[model samples]
Target: MRPISTDLDQALALLQAGELVGIPTETVYGLAADASRPDAVAKIFAMKGRPADHPVIVHIAGRQQLADWAQDIPDAAWKLADAFWPGSLTLILRRKPHVPDAVTGGQDTVGLRAPAHPLTHALLERFGGGLAAPSANQFGHVSPTTAGHVYNEFGDALGLILDGGPCTVGVESTIVGLTDAHPTLLRPGGIPAEAIEAVLGVKLIHHEKPTTAKLRVSGLLDSHYAPRTPLLVGPLAALEAEAYQRFEAGQRVALLHHSQMLQAVCGAECHAMPLNAESYARALYATLREHDGDRFDVLLLEQPPQTAAWLAVNDRVKRAASGWLA
Candidate 1:
């Protein structure tokens, strides 16, 4: 499929016409549509094959418009918003009711974000109404950190892709719901759990990934944010042993290391990064996706750092290993 450059007008036209368009964000690329247009929102689910239960995030240009989508935002939320908005962070708040149920997956809450990418802000500012978008990839698949990822996943099926280059954070926003009195983490992303706690003056509870009931957003799915290749999560020694065994069986392998892992392992395509959480989280998915291809049989990922900063990154890695079957 050939690529076509998109501008604000073209993006607005596609969205107003109820067609899906790719919008850029600092965290990742979003398959965007007018949130109020249930037909357009439904198309997002159909195109991505995302479960209706996993809600879409409404992207706004700035903080002032947040009131149009959410309600009863805690003061702590306001603080975090000021600190992180126009960047990577999503706030889950009480929906205004009239907000389309499709955007919330029939839930009372909505996930809203003000993306930092200039291209998305231009589109949202010009065509203002909540834009319900998720990462532009099949549901439960590896997210599109670059436009090529989207092109590879959806191909000619999609019409326009607004490529603002690779997402800097290389993951989704950290989603925190403040509708309740205390702020709780709905999902973790570019924002660290500690940063939120620092502002709230209290620890925010991180909920276990919801499985019994339908999920409300992309990252909340227990088995989502996965790469095409199978992932195995365990200690470096364990991963090395497993990779050796898999290699013995004639399977190609990719080894994910946390610095402590052996520098060189045979029959393994090795990737390494710092044990520090911030650096590790930023590098996680792109590293995995880089090695995820037809050439590799299994992605053997070493255990993540045992620290609070790595919490969200660890969660995603473990979930990626869980696979879509569970």
Candidate 2:
């Protein structure tokens, strides 16, 4: 097993030596490497088994260094950065000449963000360069929101794990593609679409169709953030019925619900999740990670409200539950 540390200098040393470090952000923990080094960047792909063309986001210290990594950043990009940077929004822009193709996944476009996590931000400032990072887990697996999750995923394979505690947002960054004529939401996450639009004073375009020809960003996979245990999402009544049936069959079942009136059933392990979107987002991954460890035969999640605020959490739960949906 790898050592978990609060030392940023040790992490910087490993990163400078072209090694991988598990670093925490407000959203999720990332497997970070030097973005400027192709060899270092390639290690991230190998470690996560990520496709070469699936782009990772490059984390910078602040918006001041944006021009150093990306080229031709638009006015809209600046506004979004002003509103959402140092938080969980990632801006997709044209890559600079020096950014490695490995970092951009052989595309001319690069994903950039300034994370709000104090340790990661301090690390970026001290490292003095961009760190190409994706969620610290196997490709298409449940993203890690804690350092222990990172250790659980890779064990000793990762050189260092920066123990920054539980992630506040507990999901990946919201990715917005700005290279196109209209700003498009590549992925929904920590920040909501309405919030971004409110800041820009313009409605953002939502990418509805799936295509393989253009610049690809992270967290767009159809069956991502899934746990090893099969999961299903539906109404509380339906889930409770199914859980009882499964339990009667002598199978261990886990049910996650947001309802306060719902009492723990006799046969299955029950966990109540937060009702609000923000609180729910913070607990989503950690709840999944916890239940995943119990070796339950099936996990049932009560579907959340289908509102703009619940978009990000709903996206994650939908993907997580997709594996078991027949």
Candidate 3:
């Protein structure tokens, strides 16, 4: 956790030279590269060990700059932009042909957003164009919410780590794609599905699972946002008893729960994240990272409710615990 310099000059210099840096966003920290430069964007995939088929989102400064990257902006998209721009909403639109295919993973459409982070907005304003960036963690690892999480995952791969405190949203953007101007929800994220429906006055159709699914934004992989330590997910009561049993058996068990009761149940061994959606999303990655190391064995996440707000959290947790119980 070195005191990161928010100097735009040095950051843009590295970007211009086709290098990668860790950029902050309200949702999470992103591994950023020059979007227009194919070689630079390629480094992003290689560094993260991300699959080529998984496309990245382009970071734009504002709605006005959308023309540079996207060719077809739907009317519904305009509604979304006007309502949620400069926030955590990513729109998938037809690319303008100038954005590298490598950046879009050969998809005809590219994902674009104007992140609501001051440091990143300034960088995008000065650097120009867009940056093809994804969560600043190795593919399938827990997304970084803090600068230390980025440093832990990246090690020495990153040149600049812009410390913008902690991400406010703490999850990826709510991705909506307009293929035929029929807005589709490609991913559920920081913004809830119900909120978008309320705005559009119509429920967004989830992208057909078997087709037109991944042609939208990044982080839609079947498995992603994982942690190094194995996480056992279920009711907090079930997980709580199991954690204590494991701990008593001399196993280094880490407990991730929304309930404060379990915080003292494990004494100093248990870590409690935020109870609400916003704080929970913001604290998710860092909590995983904190428990991944030292004094922990199998991690147990006290499952959140199956409400609309918990959909994205459940998706991420299910992915992280993919191979653990199965």
Off by over 4 Å in 3: 1-3, 207-216, 260-268, 323-326
Q: Say what the RMSD of model 1 is.
A: 2.7
The backbone clash count of each candidate, in order, is 2, 0, 2
Clashes of 2: 0
Instruction: Write one digit per residue (lDDT tens) for candidate 1, span 44-75.
Output: 99999887776889998878888888777667
TM-scores for the candidates = 0.92, 0.95, 0.92
lDDT of 1 at 194: 84
Question: Which stretch of 10 consecutive residues in model 3 shows the poorest summed lDDT?
Answer: 207-216
Clashes of 1: 2
Candidate 2: tens digits of C-alpha lDDT, residues 108-172: 98999999999999999999999999999999889999999999999988879999999999888
Model 2: C-alpha RMSD to truth?
A: 1.8
Residue 145 in model 1: lDDT:
77
Q: Which 10 successive residues of model 2 have the least lDDT summed? A: 207-216
